[model samples]
Target: MKELKAFLKSKDVSKSEIFKALKISYDEGLILQYLCQLFFGSIPNISILNLLQGLFKDKEEFSYLDHLKDIRHLMELGLVKTGYSMLQDQNKESLFSLLHMDISLSEYFLQFLENKKPLDLSINVAYENHLEYLKDEFERIKLYTRLSFNPQNLDFKKDIQAYEAHIKKRLAKSKFYNVLAEIFKENKLSKKEQIIFIALLKEEYSLKNEESSSRELNSLLALVSENELEKLKNRALLDENSKLIEKNLIDYDEFSNHFYLSESILQRIVNFKRLDKDKQLRLENALKDQEIFELIEPNTDINDVIMPAKTKELLENILKQQDKKVLERLSLWGIKNSKEVEAKIIFYGPAGTGKTMSALSMAKSMKKVVLSFDCSKILSKWVGESEQNVRKIFDTYKEIAQNCKQSPILLLNEADQFLSTRVESGASADKMHNQMQNIFLEQIEKFSGVIIATTNFLESLDSAFSRRFEYKIEFKKPNFKERFLIWQKALPKNAEFSEDFKLDDLAQYELSGAQIFMVVKNTALKVAVSKDGIFSMQDFRESIEKELSSSFDKSKIVGF
Candidate 1:
C-alpha cells in the first residue's frame, strides 16, 4: 500500500486526471471499476465507474468510454473478481492468452494504479487479486519491459527525485546492478559505454529500478558506430567478454595469444572471468599445460596408435565418415576448404577401460593437442547459471574452432550429471535435471565441431541424448590376449618372468589394463621398500592378493 501511494504521489498528474482518462466511455466502466477497486475503499463493479466519471469531470482531456470497450470484454467473460478466488481457478492456457495481448496496456494499467495514495484496504485487496490473476503474464511482460526500458537515459530534473524515492523502496534488495557499477568504475568505462553496459547488465541480470528503469533505451542506438555495435552485440550473445569487446574496452584475442593459448583456450579465458575464483584457477592451470596449449595447430593423421585392431578399425571408419560429413556441410554452406569442421564422439565404459588412454592416443597419433572439457569446474551452483556456463564453453569452442582452422575436440568427462533422464516429479531437483538435460541436448545438436563425451553410467542418460551422439564407443574390459599384451607392455624391461607369475596367468583375473599396471607398480614398490633387491614370484602373488582384498572392500555398495 505504501509503495503504491509513494509511486502515485511522485507523478505530476493527479488522481482526477487518471480517473477522467479511465472513465471516458460507457464501455470503460469495467476499467474504472477495477481502478476504483485499486484506488478507493470499494469493490470492483459497474457502479464505481459512474462515480469515477462524475468525480473527474474537470479533466476535459480524459475519456473513459473508449478504453472501457477493452475492459468490457473481460467483464462479459466474467473473468473479473473481487478477491483471490479468481486466481484459484485459472489455467495455464488462459494465463498465456492474456499475456500474449498488448503487454504495454498491462504496464500502463499497473503504473496508473500504483500512483494512487491513502490506505484503502478494499482497493489494496483488489489490487492484490489482480496481481494474482496476472502473475505469470507479469513475469513475461517484465522480462521484455525491463529490456526495452534502458536506465541510461534518465532525465535528472524530471525523474531523479521520484526515481531516488522509488529506488529506496522497491529496488533496495538488488546488488547485481551495483556490482556492474563497480566493474565499470574498476574498468574506467566511458560515459557512453557505461550507459550501454548498464542496459545490457539489467537485461541479462533482470534488475529492478524506478525513474532510471523508465529511461528510453533508444538513445543507445546512436551511442556506438553501427559496425562496432553489431560486432559487440553478436559477441555479447556469446559471452560476457563480448560486452567489454563491444565497448573496445579490452582485446581478448591479443591477451589470449600473448599467453600462447589456442583459440579454444582464449575463449575459455574470457568465459573463466565470469566464474568463481576456484574454478578460474582450475582452468588457468589446465591452460598452462604445454600439451593442451598446442591444440591450435592442425592435426596431421590418427592411424598410428598400436591399439587393438578392432578398436583402431572402428575409430578409423568413424573418422572417415566424420571427414566426409564435414566436407559435405562445407560444400552446402558454399565455403571452400573450411578449416572449422567439428566431429563429435562419445566413449562410454567402466573405469580403467582405456577411455582416457584412447583419447590421448588419438591425439598423439594425429599429432594434435586434445582439449578436455573440465566438467567439475564449469557446472555452477546457482540456479539457471550452469546452463549459461555450458553455453559459454560451447560458444568459446566454436570461436576457437573457426579461428584455428583446426577442428578442436571437446572431451566432456562424467557427463551423466548433465544428461540425466528427465522425470515428472515436482521436486526442485527434477526441474534442474530437466533444464540441464535440455540445455545439453540443444547444444549437442547445434554444435558443428568435434566433441567427445565420456560416462561410466550410460543408462542414466536420457534416450534423446544418446540418439544425438554420432557414435558411442563402449570400451569393454579387455580379453585375455589383450590383457597379456597390456601386462607385457606395462612391465619394466629388467623385471624377470616366472612360471607362476606369467602374463597368461595374470590375464585370467579379468582386471583392466590400468589395474594390471597398478598391480605391477605396487609389486615393484613393495620389493624396493622391503630392502629386497630381488623381486620374486611370491612377492608379486602376495601383492595381487592384497590388491584383490582392498578392491573388493572399495567396491562394496550398500543399499540406499
Candidate 2:
C-alpha cells in the first residue's frame, strides 16, 4: 500500500486525483487479498453471497454511498483490469473476440493462479474434487457477467446476447461445462466444430454404462461439412506431421470413422491431472464401464524357463542388449534414419510353451511393468467400436508409459484376434475386422513404446502385422529334455512316485509343459482324496489318460 502511494505521490498528480489513486490502492489491496485467497488454496470457487458477506461483514453502520464506492472501485480497478489482461495478454485479441469472457477469464485466472509467484500460501487440489470447484467458479462468473450485458449498441449487443443464449441453451446444463470451458479457451474450434463436438458429448451422455460411446462421421454429416471432418481426421494422427486444432484434445480413427477425447485431456477435465499413475488408473477404471487392459504384477526378478537352445539364446541376447545404444549406434553408423526408441518384441507359438513366461521374464529383467491384455476382451459387438477400443488400449498404455520411469511392456496375448489375416469378403463385419487390423497397422508404425505381442496361431496372422514385430521369436512346444526339466521343477519332493512310474516316460506324451504340470497336480489331488495320497503308478496314468482323452473327445466332437 505504501509503495503504491509513494509511486503515485512521486508523479505529482492533482489533489483529487491523488485522493482517487489512494482510494484505488486501498480497494486494489482488498481485491488482491481476495484473489490471493483463491490462488493460494485448494478452494477453487468463492460464491458471490460468501464474498459479499465477507466484504460487508460488521459494516451495517456504514452508509450505502460508501459501500457503493467500494464496489465501483473494485470493479473498475480489479476485475476490469483482470479481464482486459486475459483478453489482450496473448496479443491475439481477434482470437479472444471469438471467445466468451465467461470461459476465457476463468481459464486465465486458473492458469495464472497456477504460477507460484508472490502467492501467500500453498494451494493443493488433492483432496477436493477439482472439477466440481471449477463448476462452482463457472457458475459465479455466469451470474456476475450477466449483470453487465448491454442492450444499447446493436453490433456488440447482438454478439453478446447470442453468445450468452448459445451457451445457456447448449452448455449450461452439462456436468462437463467447466471442463469444456477450459478446453474452449485452449483450442480454436470453429462454430460448427464446437457444435459437433458438443453433440458428441450429448451422445456420450445418452449411452448406457456398457454401451459404446464412439461417434461416426456420418452422424456428423448433418452438422458439419466433409472438409471439416477430414481436417479432424488428419489432426488425430499420432505423429508430428499432424496439425492439432486444440492441443490434441481428441483422437480420431480415420478408417473406422471413430473419435473420442484423449485420456490425458479427459483426466485433466476430471481434475485428475496431478495424481500419481496408480491412483489415476484406479480412478479411471472405476469410472469406465469396462477395463481397457489387464495390468500384470510380475515378480521383481526374472524367472528361468527351459526352452529351445536357439530360442533361449535369442531371448538372452535381447535381454542383454542395450536398446538405447543399439538405436543410437544404428543412427551413427548410418544403418537407419529413424527416431524410434522402442523395442517391439513378439513371441508366438503353442500355449504353455513359454511365450507369456518369456515376456514376463523380459519385462522383469528390464525392470518395467507388464501391461498385458487379452485382445478378446477389447472386441465389442458394435460396428466401428472394436477399433476404437484398440486405440484406447494403445493410448492408455502410452499415458502409463509417460508417467513411468521405465517404459512398460504392453503384452498382448491372443494377438490373433486383431492380428489375423484380413478377409477380402464384401460383408461389413469382415470389413470392420479388417479395419481393426488397419488401425493397428497405422498405430504400430508410429508407436514409440515397447510392446510384446504373443499369439497361438502365428501362421494365421496378417503378414503386415507380423512384419512390424522387430524381435519375432517363435515359441515351440518343449521337447523331451525341456519337458523333463519342467516336470522336475513342478513336482513336489514330498510326493512319492511308484516304482514302476518312470520320469523318462512322462516326457514322451508330447504334452505341453502346462499339461504335464496339470497332470501331476490332478493325480496328486485325486489320490489324496480317494486313497493314501499317491504312491501308485495307476494314479498318474489315470490323470494323464483323462487329460489326453479330453483333447481327443473335443476333436471327435468337431469330427477331426
Candidate 3:
C-alpha cells in the first residue's frame, strides 16, 4: 500500500490521472485503497460486483483496467481461485477447466463493457491456454504489469531468459528434457533453427569433464556436415571490419584497370552486407551457375556461314583442332574443371568483311551466350580509371560465369586499336594506350572464359598480341555464289523479281553482304512507301547509287 501510494504520489503522476486511468467510480476510492492494500499485503472483504463496478465504471476511458475487474468477477463466480494456489498445485486439468469457464465469463463481461480499449482477444486466449506451463511467478507478475500498462517496454531478453528458466524448472521435475532429446535425435531441424538451437544448448549446458564436454560438442556439431561447419565458421568470422583481401589477395589496381565500372559501384557491391534473409538467399542462388549464361546475349554460328570454300575448309579444320585441344586440356585437368582451357579466338580481316559475323556465328554454333564489349564505353579519359573500369567488367563477367555454371563468350569488338603492338614514343596518349592494352592482354590470358576478338586491320595489330589467340580466322569478301545467296536471304519472301535481277551481276560491284542487304532493304522500303504497290528497277538503282555515294564521300573525308 505504501509503495502504491509512493508511485501515485510521484511528480510525474497525479491522483486524478490514476483515477481516470483506472476508470474507478467516485464512490469506489475506498475499494481502490483496499486493492492497493491487498497488492502490498492486506486482506479485504468486499463483494466482487462492487470491485468490478469500481474498476469498469468508465470502460471507454480505461478499458485495460476492465480485464483486472473481470479476473475478480471470475473469482467471485467460482470460475477461478484467488492467489497462486491453483498454479502451485500442479493440477493442470482442473486449472484448464476453471480457465474455460473464466474465458466464457470474460467474453460476456467484455461485450457488456462497451466502447472498451482495443484488446487482442487472441493474445488473451493464448495466455489462458498456456497458463499452466507459466511457472515463473516473477515473470508472470512482470508480464501482467507490462501488459496492463506499457507493453511496448516489454524486454525480449528478459522474456527469453524467463522462458528458459521455466523450461529448466519443468525439465528438473518431469521427463520433458528426455523427450526433447529423443525428438531431436529422430528429426532434423532447418539450418536456421539448428543454429539457434545449438547456440541455446551451448549456453544452457556446461560439461564439467573434458570427455563429456567433447561428446556434447560433437553431438551438437553432428547436426551439420563438415563443409557446413566450415562455412558457419567462416561466416562467423566475417564481422563489420572484415576485408576481402584477407581471404584471397587480389590485385585491386590491376583489376580496376581491366573493368570500366566506377570504384564506388564496385565497393558498394563487394561490401554489401545482406540485411534481408530472402535477399541473401536470392544472392546465393544468383551466385550459382544457372543464371550466369543468361547475362550474355545469344551469338551467331560462324561455321554455317558461306565463304570461299577453301578458306572455309581450312578455318573449320583449325577451329576443330583448337576445340579438340581445349577439350583435351580440360580432360587432363578433369571434366567440369574450368581452370585448364584458355578460350580465346582471333578473327582478322579487312573492313566490311565477316569478322564480327564469324565470331557471332561461332558462338551460335557452340550454343553459348555472347557478350560484346564496347571498348569505347570501358575506356575513360581519366587517368588510371580506364583500367579499373575494364577490370570491373571482367570481374562482373567472371562472377556471372561462376553463378551460371557456364563460360560466357567475350566478344571484344574492334581489337586492333587497343591491342596494337606499337610502342609509345613517351607520349601521354601512347602511354595510356600501352597501359590499357597490357591490362587487356593480361586479363584475357588469365581468363578461363571464352573470348573472340575481331580486327579489321590484321597487319596493324602487334604480332605479340596476335600470338596470344589459339585460332586466327580470316574473313574475306563473299564470292559470287555466296553473294547470290546473300541477296536471296535478304529479299522478302513474297517479292517478285525479273530475270534481269541477277545477283551475280550485282556481285561484280564488289559490295559487301551487309551493303547488299542494306540496298535491298532501302529499295523495298521505297516500293512499300509509294502509292502504287510496284517494285521498280529504278528504285533499286537509286538505292545502290545512294549507298555508293555515301561510302565514297566518307572515304574521301578520311583521305583513304
Candidate 4:
C-alpha cells in the first residue's frame, strides 16, 4: 500500500514495487502511471487531448507531443488499446487526429490497478459443458492474438504458452471439445489447422456479419508461421489437396485471397452437440440408420487369416496407418492427404475364398469398423426400384464415415453385380443398368476412404471400375500349405479327436478357407453328439465330401 501510494504520488518511483511490476522504461512508466490515475479518476476512457491536457497541467515542463510515440509503444505492448482500429495509420495527419482519439488501458492492466495485486495468471476454470469450454477458448485465443501485437517481446510467447498449457489441462477433463476434438481424434488435421478453425469459429460466435469471419489468407498464414520461409511452406494448408480443404472444414476464396470456416462448421455452431463418443460406442451406433450397410466390429487379426505370403504381406501393409512415421511419409509423398491410409481395393477370387475374412481382419488390424454392404442385395432389393439404389450405397457409406473418427472400412461384398461390364446399347432395362453402372463409377471415383470391394469374378468387372481401385488382390483357393494351416486353426481344441485323425490328410483336400471352416464345423457337430465325443477320420471325410458336393450353394453369410 505504501509503495503504491509512493508510486502514484510524486516521488522517487524507482523504489516502488508497482514500478518494478510495470517492467517498462522510466519514461514509459511515468506515462503509464498517469493512465493508471486516469482509470481511477475518470470514466476509464479518455481522449488523447484530455490525457495530454491533464499531463501538461500537472507537469508544465512535460513535452506531450514527443511522448505520443510512447503512447503508441504502450498500445503495442497491450497496456493500452488504440481505439477500435489498431491498424490506424501513423502519418503526421493521422497522428494529429490521434490527439482527439479515445483510448483505454487493457482489461488485464485495469484489473491489476483496481486490485493493486497481480491477476491470477493461472488457468483454473472448470467447464461443465462444451459451450462453456468454447466460450473460454475464444477468450484465450483473443488473448494470444493480442499478445502477437508485440511479437518482439519473447515474454508474450511465454505467456501464451502458459495459458495454452492451462487450457489443455482443463480440456482434458471433458468428453468432447466439438470440432477440435473431432478432427484431432480422426488424425485429419494438425494443430496449426485446428487453431485456424477455432479462430474462425470465434469470429462466428461474435455478433459480426458473415464476411468478418473470413480472414485474409496472408493473416492466417502469419497465425501459423513464425518466419517468412515457414509462412511460404504453410500455404499448402489451403492447397486443393490439404486436409483442411479436402475435408471441407475450410473454404478458400481464390479471387479475394480469404479463408473462412466452411458452412458445415458454421451450421454446427448454434447447436453444437458432442462430436465424439467412446470408441466402442461409436462402433455400436455407426450403423443405426445404415439401411444398406451392416457395421461389423471384427476381432480377427490379419495374422489369423490363412493366405499366400504375398497376400499376407499386402494385408499387413494396410496397418501402416498405425505407424506415425509411415503416415507422415505417405503424406509427404502426396500419396495420402490425411493421416489415414486411404485405399480402394478389389479382393477378387472364386467363392469360399477368404476375401471377406481378410477384409474384416484387415479392418480389425487397423482398429476400424467395417460397414459391409451386400451389392447382391442391390439387385435383389432394387426389384421394385431397379438400379435406382446404386447411389444410395456410396451415400450411406459417406454418412457413416463422417460419424466415425477412424475411417470405417467400406466392405462391398459381391460388388460384381454392379461393377460388371456396363451394357452400351440395348433395351430399356439395359439402359437402366448402364445408368446404374455409371452412377456407381462416379461414386467410386470421388470416394476418399478405406474401401474394399469383394467379387467372385474380377474378369467381369468393367475396365472403368477396375481402374479406380489402387489394389487388385487375388484370393485364390488355398493350396496344400495354406489349407493345412487353415485346417489346423479351424479345428476345435476342446473336442476330442481320434489318434488317427491327422490334419495332413485333411490338408490334402483342395479346400478354400471358407470350405475348410464349414467342414470343420460340420465334423465338430458330428463329434459333439456322438457317444465317444471323438472326431474320427470317417467323420472328417464325410464332412469334406458334403462340403464339396454342396459347392453349388453359393450363399454368403458373415459372422464377427
Candidate 5:
C-alpha cells in the first residue's frame, strides 16, 4: 500500500498499480486513469463521446488525430471494450457512428482498477468440448468479419496470427480443431482454404445450419477477400473446380446456391449426435424381400452392343459423366444440379431391337446395378391398384436409395401401355390409366437418379412423357450392317464351320439380331449332332426358316 501510494503520488506513470496491472504505456495509462475515474463517478461504462471529451480535456498537448489514434490504441490494448450496439451498426466505419459507440474499461481491468490490486491475466481458456470450442471460435471469427469492413485494419495479419496461435493452443483439447486439422492436412488446404472451412464449420455448429448460401458464405469469406476482385477469386474456390468440392470434402446444392459438407466428410468431422445407420447393410437386408424388381449385374457394357452410330454417340455422352472434367463442366453449365450424374432416358424401338440390352449395358458401363422392372407387373387385376403399383415403383426406389450409397439404375422395360396417351374419359379403366400416368409423370419430373423407360416406339409416348426424357434414343431393327456385326459376335467360338458356310448369306436374311442369335444357337445344335460335325449354311438356313415360321404344329414333335 505504501509502494502504491508512492507511485500514485509520483509523476512516473509506469510505477502506478493500474499501469502494472494492465502493462500499458504512460500515454495509455493516462487515458485509462481518466476512464477509471469517470467509470465509477458516473456509470460503470462511459459513452464514446464522453470518454473522448474526458481523455482530451487538454487539447493543446494532443491534436484531434492524436485523440482518434489514442482511442484506437486503447481498443488495441484491450483496455476499452465496445458493446454490440456499435459493432452491429452497418455504418460503424463512419466517424459519426464511432462516437455513438459505448465504451468501458474491460471487466477484467475494472476489478483491479477499482480495488487498486494487481490483476492476474493468466488462465486456461482452452475449451473442453467441440460445441464450446465452436461457440468461442465463432465469436473470435466475427472479429475478423468486422475487421474486413473496417478501413483501419492495419493489424489484420497480426490478428490472424494470434487467432491461429490460439487455435493451435486449443487443438489438443478441441476435437473440432483436431478433426479439422486432420482434414486440412489430408487435403493439403492452403491458409485461405482453412479459414473458409473453419468459418463454414462455425456456421454449422454455432448457427445450427447445415448449409450456407453463396451470399452468406461470401461475406464470411471476406476475411480473406480484400476487394471485389479478390472476392471473386474466393468464390472460385467453391466452384466446380474447387478442391474442396472435387475432393468430396464439400457439397453444393446448385439449385439452392448453398454449400455444405459432403456426407463422406460430415460424419467424420462433425460432432452432431444423430444416429445414422449403415445404408449399404440396410439396402442388403431390404433387397431380400422385394419381388417387383429383377436385380441384374450386366455382363455387357455399351461397347458390347451393335447399335446405330447416333445411338452409340448419345450413350457415350451419358457415360461421359464418369469423367471428372466432364462432370465439372456439367455442373458449371447448370446442366446438372448435384455432384452425381442423373439421367431420365427413353429407349424406344421394335421388340427384337436392343432397347433392353442397351439399357442394361449402359448400367454396366456406369458400374451401377440394374433394377429391371417389367412394366407389365405394374398393371393389377384389382381395380385402383395400378396407380398404387406405379407409386410403389418410386417408393421402393427411394427406400433402396436411402438405404444404399450407390443408387441402382431404374429400368422400366416394355412400357408401351404405360406411356400411351392419357384419354379424357370417365370410364373406370381410362380413369385408372390416366391416374397412373399422372403419378408416373409426377415422379419422373422430380426423380434425380438414372431412370430409363423403354417402349416399342417413341410415337407411343405421350408428349408429356416424351418431354421428360433427357435422352430419346430409338432402336431401329438391326439393318444388314448391324446384323452382320451381331452375327459375328454371336458365332460360337468353340464350334466348327464347313468350308462352304458364308456369313454374307446369313446377314442377307433381313433377320433381327435376336433371330440371328437363335439361328446360330439352333444351327450349332444341329451341326453338333451331325455325323459330319460341321457348321454348314444349310444347317443355319433350316433354323432360320423354322425361327421365321410363326405357326406351330403339334405333329412336329414327332419329326425326329
Candidate 6:
C-alpha cells in the first residue's frame, strides 16, 4: 500500500486523487481503474460500470450515480474524453459515450505501475507475458500436425522454437531486423540461403570482445556439418546468392575463404537492448575498434599551414569540385560523369617536410573528418592476412564516408610500404607482394572518396600507382623566406626573443619544416627547465645543434 501511494505520488498525484477522480469509495474500484488504464489504455464508461457491479455487487451503498460522478470529474480534468458528447441526442438514444484515456498519461501511469505493481498490475511484464501467450498459440496452431510425415516435416518442437525466435527478432527496433524480415518475406529464399543467413545470425550473437569471436564464414563451417552444407549447396546455385553480396548484406573474402555479414547488420543485432544485459555488453566489447585507425577532427586550418603555393591552389580547386553544388552542376554540363566524385592525392618529399600537416590542414579547410590508417598496425606478417586487412580498411572508410555530409579523407602516412615498386616475381613471396599492389590498385580505381597518402620516397612508389593519383604535390624543404615564416609561426607571442636571435640566420641550415618545429619545441622545453621559463639565444642554439646532430646520424644510415 505504501508502494502504491509512492507510485501515485511519483506521477504528481496522490492516492486520494485517484479515488476522487474515479468516483470510487472502495480501494478495489481504484485498483481496477488503474489496471484498466494499463491494459486498455483507458477505462471505458461501460468497463467502469461493469467493474463496479462485479467488484462491489454485495455493497448496498455503491450506486450508478457514483460512477457517473467519477466519470464527469475525469472528463473535467481532461484525463479522459467521451467518444460522443454525453449531452448530445445520439447518446440518449443508445449506450452512453465511451470514455477514452489520455494516451500520454496512460503510458506514463503504466510505467509508474510497472516499478510498483500495485494490486499486481504491470505493463512492464507484457513482453515476458507475450512469450507465454505465444507458447499457447504455438501449441494450438500445431495441434493437428503429425510427426510421422516426412524426415523434413516440421518437427513440432523445432517449429515452435523457430517461431519463437522469429517473434523475438521482430520485437527489435533495429533496421537490420526490418530489412531481414522484409527480404525473406518478399523474395523466395532457397533453403540454402536461409541456412546461411541463420548461421550468420547465430555467429553474430556468439561473438565476445574477450575472445577471437569474429563471425567469419570459415569459422561458421564448424557450426554446421559438411554433409548439411553439401545438401544446401545442391538446392541453390551459390551464384544465386550474389544479390546478397551486391546489397552489402554480406561480404565474401575470396582470399580468406570467409564471409562477413555487413557491419551495419552485425552492429544492429549486437546493440539491440532486448538481449540479456551481460550478452549486450559482451557484444559491444567485441565490435569495438582496436584503434588501428585514428579519427582526426579538423584541427589545422589550411590558411595557417605553410606549403608551396601550387600545392595550396591544387587542394582548393579539388575540394571546391567536391562540393555538392559543384558536382551537380558538373553533371548537368556532362563535364564530370562519374556517379560519385573522388580526389586521390599524393604528398611526397623528404622526411619532416609537412606532407602530413598539409593533409590535416586541407581536411580542416574542407570541413571533413580525417581517418588516419596506422600502416604498421595494418601490414601483417601472414601472407593473405595483410591483403584482407587492407580490404577491411577500405570497406570501413566507405561505411564512414556514407554517413558523413562531407566524405572523410583517408590518410595513409609514410605510405612507401603500401605503394612501393612492384618488383618482378622472382619468388613466391615476391608474387604475393605484387598481388598486394594489384589489390590496392583495383580498390583505389573503384574508390569514390578522397584519399591523401604521404611518403618520404616518391621514387620508390610504383609507376602504375603514381599514375592513378590525380594530384602529386612535391613537398620540398622550405626556402629561406618560408623557413622564417615557419619559425615565426612556431614562436610563442608572449616570449621575448634575444636581440641576437635572428630567424634569417637560423634558416641558413638545411632543415625541414618539421625540424624547425622540433627546434622551437625543444628550445621552449630548455627555457622552462634551466632558464626559469625565459626564452634566450643560448637555449635556441643548443636545440638547433641537437636537431642537426640527429639529422646527420639519420643521413649516414640512409645515405640521404
> Model 5: per-residue lDDT, tens digit, 471-503?
888888777788789999999987788898888
Instruction: List TM-scores for all candidates, in order.
Output: 0.42, 0.46, 0.44, 0.50, 0.50, 0.47
Q: Is candidate 4 or candidate 6 better by lDDT?
A: 4
Residue-level lDDT tens digits of model 3 in 97-168: 332231211111122222323322222112221223322332333233222222233352355445546545
lDDT of each: 0.49, 0.56, 0.49, 0.71, 0.68, 0.58
What lDDT, from 0 to 1, does candidate 3 have?
A: 0.49
Worst 10 residues of 1 by lDDT: 252-261
Q: Give the Å error, residue 317, model 2.
A: 1.8
- lDDT per residue for candidate 4 within 278-369, as digits (tens), equals 64466456556445778788888798787899988877777666565576677799877675668899999988888998899988777688
For model 6, what is the alpha-carbon lDDT of residue 193?
55
Decoy 2 TM-score against native: 0.46
lDDT, candidate 2, 1-560, per-residue tens? 44334333332322333223223455444533454445445544453334445655766743222443343333322232222231122333433232222111132123222322231113322214434444333332322222222213244335444544644544434543355655665465655455455545543444523122124333332223323344345333322232232345555654444556556655555443444668667646633544756666567334477778888788766664444345557779986555333578778877777788788877776667778788887667899998898788777777666655456788888787678888999998998888988888898898765788888887887889878888888887777789889888877788766778777767666777777788888877787786556556667667777887876323111110
CA deviation > 4 Å runs, candidate 1: 1-308, 321-341, 374-379, 398-405, 497-501, 530-532, 552-560
Off-target runs (Cα >4 Å) in candidate 6 are: 1-288, 322-329, 337-341, 402-405, 552-560
Q: What is the per-residue lDDT of model 6 for residues 77-173, given as tens digits with 9 covering 90 to 100?
A: 2233333332233324433333222211221223223332212112222334333433333332222111111113345345545554554543442
Candidate 4 Cα errors over 4 Å, as ranges: 1-291, 380-387, 553-560
TM-score of 3: 0.44
Off by over 4 Å in 5: 1-290, 402-405, 551-560
Candidate 3 vs 4: which has more lDDT: 4
Going through the candidates in order, what is the number of backbone clashes in each?
14, 0, 27, 0, 0, 0
Quote the lDDT for 179 in model 4.
59
